[model samples]
Target chain A: MPTWSRRSPPGWSWPMAEKKMVDVFSDVERETAMTANPAGYAVTELGAEDERIVTLAADMSNTVAEFIAKFPERYIECGIAETNSVSLAAGLASAGLIPYIYSMSPFGMLKTCEQWRTDVDYNHLPVRLVGRLSGLAMGYFGTSHYAVEDIAIARTMNNTVVLSPGDAASCVSLMRSTASLEVPVYIRIAEAVSRVYDEAPDYEFGKWPRLRTGSDVTLIGHGMGLGLCAAAAEALYEHDSIEADVFDAAYLRPYDETALLASAAKTGHVLTVEEHSVAGGLGSLVAEAIARAGLSVRLGQVALPDKDLEVGVPADLYEYYGLTPSNVAAKARSLVRR
Target chain B: MPADITLERGRALTEAELLRRADWVRLQTIDLIAQAGLGHYSSTFSCAELVATLYYHALRLRPAEPNWPDRDRFLLGKGHVATGLWPVLADLGYYPHDWLKQFGKVGSPLNDHPNMKLAHGIDFSSGSLGHNLSVGAGMALAARLTGRDYRTFVLTGDGELQEGQVWEAAMAASHYKLGNLVAIIDANGFSGAGPTSQAMNIEPLAKRFEAFGWTVREIDGHHAPVLLRTFDELPDPASEEPVAIIARTRKGHGVEFMEKQPQAWHLGLLNAEQYADVVAEISARMELANG
Candidate 1:
């Protein structure tokens, strides 16, 4: 092994390779990067305001190092023990401190689901569980790391308030919004996302933020679901001249029935989209509401199949599952045309 | 915290008194299980002495002020033995002693496991194994960060050691140097399946704890005098190491039939005759204690 010190044994630096350094992206991709890593900002801001806001990550200091640096005494580096990190958060919550536990989606939500249920949700402890890289965000990591089923597993737990942010702004606002809720909360975050809002919108629990207005059809989504719905709305208006009301159904559990029903009544047709399995996710939540309320609106779901996932990039999985904006627009057009 | 078993002070409990309390816990455990016609028996009996020592001699708690900020916290890591602990809590004046008779009755707050909200004097509610330690570590950390002097104790099961969460907590407790936190694993050698060795060998637990940076202690779990002394001597809270007391014990401490039974009365009905026999056996054991 060759060892290099500050002296630089060989030509380690000053090697300038001339290349055309250009930022390549269409007008759309630029906007997507505007709101990346929202939860990190939200947690850092939350820590600044409240001294009781402590953070613990299971071997994820890199993602949360800035927040840890800001609150060194409060930050706990839990070192890959997802179960312990969550259980420790429960303990920290019990001791009158608000603990924000962060980790990769699968490990944070699914790996420690029992711990979350028994420790935090069971007592309604004021602990926040944030699952970063949710859905197919870990596209190449395969099924083990995918958190598409996070909504299904997290929402079904007793007294668990499951929140999934569609973009950077919603993710940040919703993180701040949950400060007062004295219940266990699960926040699923996605990295590769589009900035749906120009600025932070007024986010409320159990209420959908109505993004675009239309009377023909309703496009509902949460987490990555909202981003897809927003794009599909743009696609619908540009191509088919069909306008659909798009709502951010980010709060998956204790879902906003009033808003959903009212939107369904206005639109008379509903289309749901999400980067998750069609079963036990945003689509399922909307479908259950439509049936239970005896709504007459036509319902369609643009979501991944509940089967073995095909290996590919996040975009590949999304496109294959018909999770693209065009697929969502087409689905909404068919529902409204009916 | 900060105290190891080498020192002793306070109103020291005699071996006889500790034995008497153990008898009381055993007797009440039998009745609680008998009334429900189903409850953990041998598991509870195995830790009878340890729990009795903690409540009667070790923990610093005011029954009247269960939430006393300065008071020590006790979390039942092995919540299956919660039925055996109710009598101790009631006898300590935290709740009415009569609640024991309604162990598992309809609408009764008492369940098979402990619930902090439902049960008084329960600092952390735990049923599934390997959780109480982390919760206790939190309490210990709170005590230290908030400039309070208090200790947190968690009683875990030998079988519960198989859980990965316990080691995670063990590592955290040591990393934080939570000297105020103590973990007492009830190494009764049996779980629901069979012997712990058969299920998953968690032997060499003391060495594992040492490697995890904890002051480890081994003691006869059924002995009251030693437990009382050992708890008193736990290192000072300033020490940067948590404590692990591996209390060696049997699956069942009394009632030979129940002790000898496979699975050791994990859950079953004690018929009227069998119940009377167990009661008689406990009394006879208590008589031997007086001798």
Candidate 2:
């Protein structure tokens, strides 16, 4: 079982030192034990229910292997053409079929931005674009494979619902929820992290999930960043007796403004952490929201610098960029103390 | 439906009537562009007969039911020539003929490009080049998956062949053997800048498509009999090979001055005297054909 399985009631403050000491290997092991790849399972399940659900792969078959195996006729291998695949999905959607295109983040989102803009979003077609290995998860593959700019691009498109899943369970739940959506959706799938929920949480579009409660500061994150926020909250309490509110900002486009304002009002300080550029990722989104709401709250960001990043193992890169729990906690402590 | 029009799905038109309709398309296109003051007149003129054949004779569509699920779909990859298609849709009662005068105006559904959401009878929105073929392939694949027999036809420009995504779609369409998809390339010899060969040669076009595993056919685009015969003999939807029709045509076929200077007339406004000349020429041709 994962160490995060323990539930903490709202307004409850507890030191997470014991849980923090748990090795990263055990977390990976727990994730594998829970589910191998929740996306593949979820797609196969959705295929059984909706015959209109078809999948197009840009030569990324392994990401949706189970669905291809079960419903081979419904799977289209679009070669390595991401642009053509997106337009193809739009064509299918125009003809009363819901099509999903799955590929690595760079090829899926960055390479086919115009296709998504003109072919899918402009036409208001219900095409699902799934981009895996989001952010710096493609660690050693260098800057070419990094998806730090995907969120910025996706959010700029009209009639597109942008979402990032925090864990395997949320990945399944978020994808399944998009079945009845009549507009295009872009689902960013981050690298596997420890399970945040025992089962799938009831998800609502434009609503943020409050993972832990605190009064000193609010830590907002999405996808892999959410897990880091939870760990940083525990560390803040353990080291400096500072309670930090942690939130999962899964829906980036239609983000929950009411919850964000209430949390900012309660904490008076907001810090956003993400495995993306500090320019237009979650940090920029929060800043825009804060300004639009005219809230007088201090905001800080813990994100990758907006420049060319170095190539190395993901763990080494995270440590060098100050994305670890300790670095996040230290940043939160400074924000609360100031 | 319009009170002045009778709705007939797949009405068999005579060769002479088809030719007359093609001339009517040219006349309407000239009028629309002359009204809009900024439109692709030559581009519309090049594909006039092809568009008329598809709308009046080739396609299976109901004017009363534009969104019929089983209706055949038509996408304009070279969407700048949408002026030619709008009039046909209006005549079919997809919308009122009065909307043709509102072309390119603010809030008008009829822009220089085709938008499926804004306009009736447009199967897909297309302005950016080289996207509609892939969209057609997608619709073709959808037909097979959904067990529907609706065919999808895409009209692409010769210059649009330069876009990499077009070939990407070409490769995928042939790879999937999308027999329900038909690509009609308007090889009018000129693009917006100049002649396609001088700008970027896409010659040996038929062999290129043959190499991509598509059934290739070439014909004089302006000839009504050839256009009708080629469309009638298209491969079955259940067949294994997609079809590519390379329609050899002039940049501006009917108008004498425009045909002479295809490069200059690619996009230009006609003065009152020039518009009168074009009208007289088309009317003379109609009278000659009728006699």
Candidate 3:
């Protein structure tokens, strides 16, 4: 009943406080961990449970097909025929079997886009679209292979739910749930496995989970970028007095309205981070929500440029675009001081 | 000649009725296109008899229950001729005849192409060429998976063969040996810009399908009895391979003015005098059959 304050004391902590600590999970760690790339192990586990879950790859199996070989009958080796593979998967989806259509991000999502839209989305059919190497994960593969515009295009569709899971556990949970989903789901799979949540990490579709809470600044990131945000938050606390609240938005299309509002209200300053183009990534969605809700938060966007990214490794590109922890921490410091 | 039948039924379609309906379907397509200001009339006219044969006699479908699991599926891969499909569907009681009255109107479900979500009796939305064949392949596979005896039919324009996805499905169908699936290619010489031979010519059409492990057949598209006989006697999906029926057709079969003229392929409007000529011509053909 006390007067509410953005910087409320410890007594004001919500139920989410008990679930805030990051538990260590070692099932699918790739030497390093981040908040992005939740789908790696879950995709593998879902493949283990269901024999009908097939993964079709267009020459890229290293980064995305880890789970495919576990169930051979559930995988098809279609070399470079993106359109045919998509159409065939759509056909297979009709057979009551879930088919995960996988390929590189740009080639998979944009190359056979028309076929995907026609065969999968328009049909309102449940065909899992997996963009294996999302965003700048192609590294030296250059601008031609980078899938920076996927979120925007996928958002325009009717029955297609776009997902950018930020850890292995979330990815596995979402993949398993997609079996019963009536609509199409597009998962942008990051090249590296970032973080592993605790065994009891309850995941929900279209809902954002708050990892860290602070009153000074709110940091929002999705998919692979979420790890960067989490890393940046830790850096900010060590170097500067600013405490930032970090939220992981797994579903890109339907943003979590309640989490977005609460975060925006808590901190007048909000920053969105993504590996996709700044034009239509999480930044655009958060900004739109802020404007709609009539909230007066100063929104800062951190995403790749609208133009094609230069050739480099995923880490180099992430650093080049100030997507690394130190760079994000510096950007947050500058914005908070302003 | 009368269509081959079980003898007691006499014919799949009376020769006179076949001739009259084929002509009617052709002219009606032209009229609808002209009225709607859009259609693939040339392609529609070419496949008129084949479509008429299926609707009037061959396909075991119930218009009342379009989603009946046991009902046979007829998927039109070349969906530009949605104008032609409307009347045939209406005649078959798939929809009311008055539904065509709103063709091309704003917000009307009856667009230039068929959309499964927007329109009833349409199993799949097509227009992005070569898609329906794969969808039909899936439907055929679904029948097998569900243990249903229903067969699946897909019609693709010969020009649409240029799409590589079609060949992919063609290969899949052959490899899976989907004999319950019959793909009919309306081999009209002309396409959108000009004659297909002048565009990207693909000849020996039936041979190409055969190489893909399909049971292929070539037939005169204008001949209704031949089409009826083949459709009625189609093999089961358990056959060694899928089936492809290549229908050799002229661009515009009944309408002399539009015949072979690709420009007239889908003119959705005809002046009063032109309309009169079409009506008179159809009247004469009907009278000749009656006499």
- Top-TM-score structure, candidate number: 2
Which runs in model 3 stand beyond 4 Å of their true positions? A1-55, A59-77, A94-97, A292-294, B1-11
lDDT string for model 1 (A122-219, tens) is 98899999998888877766788788788888878989998888877888888888887899999988765676887878877788889999988899
lDDT of 3 by residue, A47-101 (tens): 6776556676777665444665566445566666777778777766765667777
Best by lDDT: 2
Backbone atom clashes (below 3 Å) for every candidate: 12, 0, 13
Classified by CAPRI criteria, candidate 1 counts as medium
Q: Which prediction has more favorable lDDT, 1 or 3? A: 1
DockQ of each: 0.66, 0.75, 0.34
Which parts of model 2 have CA positions greater than 4 angstroms off?
A1-27, A30-34, B1-10
Candidate 1, residue A119: lDDT: 92
Model 3 residue A245 distance off true place after TM-score fit, in angstroms: 2.3
lDDT of each: 0.82, 0.87, 0.76
Task: Give model 2's TM-score versus the native structure.
Answer: 0.93
Pairwise TM-score winner, candidates 2 and 3: 2
Better of 2 and 3 by DockQ: 2
Question: Could you tell me the lDDT of residue A121 within candidate 3?
Answer: 93
Instruction: Looking at model 3, give its docking quality level.
Output: acceptable
Interface RMSD of candidate number 1: 1.1
